[model samples]
Target: MTSVYPYLPEMIASFGVERKDVAKWAGATSAVFSVAQSLTAVPWGRASDKFGRKPIIMTGLFCTMCFFLAWGVSTSLKMAIIIRALQGACNGNVGIIRTMVAEMVQERELQPKAFSIMPLVWSVGSVFGPAFGGLFAKPAERFPGLFGNSYFFNKYPFALPNIIGGVVFLISLSTAMLFLKETLHSKRHSRDWGLILGRRITEAFKDRPFRRQQKLRRYSIQDAEASAPLLQTDGTSRPAKAGREKPVAPSMSSVFTRQTVISLVSYTFLALHSVAFDQVLPVFLNYPPQEHTPRNTSLPFFFSGGFGLNSGHIGTIFTFYGITSGVIQFVLFPPLCARFGVLRCFRVCVLVFPVIYFLLPFTVLVENATTRYAALLVLMICKAFAVIIGFPCSTILLTNSAASLSILGTLNGFATTFSALGRASGPALAGLAFTWGVKNNMIGAPWWILGFIAAVGSLPVWMIVEGEGPTAGSSDSSDAESTDAEEEAVVFDDDDDLLDNLTTARRGSGREQQGLLKKGSEDTRNTGYGTVR
Candidate 1:
């Protein structure tokens, strides 16, 4: 979509369609794609748990490759839309990949670092996707028969770029299929569906050790109160109770509790703001000048030279942001979380995002070539920081929250779905805002809107609790220990039974050394020791 966006006008012209109509069409397509794409996360996650992560991932990749190939060869709008929809339907691996990594890696301490790498890779993809699109979309006469006649060039000048995208997808698909391994643990076959589901739910509730700790604290308080009379200044004495105290009511885990739900809602808003800003930035930046002049081309060195952004550049920027964020997640975030706590780190990131968006609108204000270039550079740096901080932090929070709930897979799917919805809706909303602003001759208004939206979105981050009970890592460790203990007990019982069997066999066989010697002596003498003589 990033690569082919430049040819939208051309496509509209060829199809004899209005810009508004095209925008509506694209927006609708985006929404549809978003909803379909969201569904893949949880099911893929559950499938990973059921079968294996590797196979499910490979399946998704295969589907993506096929979809992209179809998209590249699409001859009409209907074909393109269908292909795009299919692509959305198939590319549902992100959430699954997140879960797989979480499952495979221990030291919940490493989670932030591990998750950061995803955004980094996405950023790299963003940089290349459009550059390749722009490069390949060049006139066919330039390459002649490089890709056979000028049919593609005539019908769709950007066809080569789409082909490149398809090829990339294929390569990615193959690499994933060959290299990726299953991360989830294998479970025993169970014919009892009710038991399985119930157990999973029960485990989720039980996973939160925070509740247990709370119970212990309450019990300790009660014990302290009960013992207070012994230490009273009046020296009152009471007989000790022989009966045990009633058991305390079980404490509910906070993983899927109200607090977690609020945090998720906050994240949803942040996602909405982030996606909207990302979607609209390019449109706002590359707005055509009111009066066409050669001077307009003198925009800025960054905008004119290597860093210059067209729509493709915008996509590249997003890809860069994604890759950078992913990297931070995989490499930097875990350590940061361990040091600062997830909520603290998340709040800091959320607070900074709006500032970055605010600065983006000012890029156009610096008219001097160097100043304007510097402004754009600053914007990119800030944007990179925003991505790095916001993404990994949010993901860490979500994963941590889910881990607490023992519904990591389900929560992950839900998060992905909401994220997708935001991503899908954001672009269309941004497009609508941009189109309205531009048509109404309200220059730079959309940037302000984006910034304001981002600022408002940050409000939700405040709801997140710091140092909420046990970290996900600690919870997992406790669970592992419990499982080990259970296994050890079973082994101990088996050993005990085996020891009993051996003792019985020895007695039954009369295999004691002394017994054997006495029997042998009695047989030789035809009498027992004293009696034999």
Candidate 2:
């Protein structure tokens, strides 16, 4: 995915697209991918909730493999666009993977360590993907000794890199299939692979006419116990008897408290501005320098223009940035987050974004290539670090803000959907801004605009009040469900109503919250309501 950005012009040109329209076409291609993500994210997340994370993840990887293979073979611009969109539509694994990480590692204090791996992986991929795309693309032309006159390479010039990408996904899929554990608590009890397979086969054959030919033995209570026996009160296992049954836990609802809503909105704003900046920065870095004119002679090449670099040079720079990002995320971020606390660190990082945005466009001032590259490496590292630090912090906040495990998938889905919308709009708008600024002899206008937007993105952070982070072994699922309900009720009830309710709750010796909790427990037991979570 990161590879696609640096090679946009080459890919666009292969379809006989004109040079002037390259920016527009590149923006459209990127936009369509996000559009597809926006449409499918929610449904994929919901499916994962119903089934399991591994299933959805594997499905996504399979689709991506197919998409990459198809992309390599595409003959037209429209085919490439369709392939990209298909990849996005089937690639809603981000949220589901986050959900898995959250579930697998529950302690809030340790969450930074766990979540840091995500950005590290991304950084590594971002570093190598561009290098591979830039160096190995159109292999028949680039590496004549190896691929010249080879029928496959001649016919599909970009096949080598794309095939390598597909193979990478294939390896990931195989590793996941072999080693990834199912983390869903609800499904944990029935996780015997044999039983699962048998159940699936039975279901598949139930409606077939051949199924009626054999006398099928009814599943006995002993079989149920053998498959998934109930847990004893003493943390041991025992077969469930007739009358006594454990009460089902409460499901998290879609309705969010004021804090969760504010945090989500803040995240959306930050993502919108950040993505736009990312899209514009790469394009600007590779653009040709503006010619000197009498009226525009005052504008330094550094302030209002770019350091003219080709695709390969730009990819190398990004590779360095990615390396720096990996070190920061792995070695730097966790301690900073632990020391300052997640919310405070998030605030500090977000506030620094505008500064990074403003400073990035000034790298053109250094005339020497080595000095210019060093300056950009430092500036870009700082910028990437800020975002890397804030992103996982924001995710932790979202997960902690969620009501319970039952609705975790839904919350992450919502977050991804909003992010997709932001990403979908960002590239096109930023590209348009860049195109317009360059046309009007105001090359720095886009940077100035992006910096201002980033500043605006920081505003919503103030609305999210911090709370105590979840601690290890403090509350199990049931207690968490009840406590989250109480907190949500106290925090989100209207201000006027809150005062009255608090007074009433005090008069009842704080029994009001208990009553609400009890009522919720009863609803869970009586109705077994399966939806809304």
Q: What would the per-residue lDDT of candidate 1 be over residues 394-426, giving only the tens digit for each residue?
A: 776666555432355556666677777776776
TM-score of model 1 vs. true structure: 0.67
Candidate 1 has its poorest 10 consecutive residues by lDDT at 220-229
Per-residue alpha-carbon lDDT of candidate 2 for residues 184-224, written as tens digits (9 for 90 to 100): 55454343454445444555667666545321212211123
Model 1: lDDT of residue 295: 55
Off by over 4 Å in 1: 1-28, 138-148, 187-255, 291-339, 403-406, 466-533
Query: Candidate 1 at residue 48, lDDT?
Result: 55
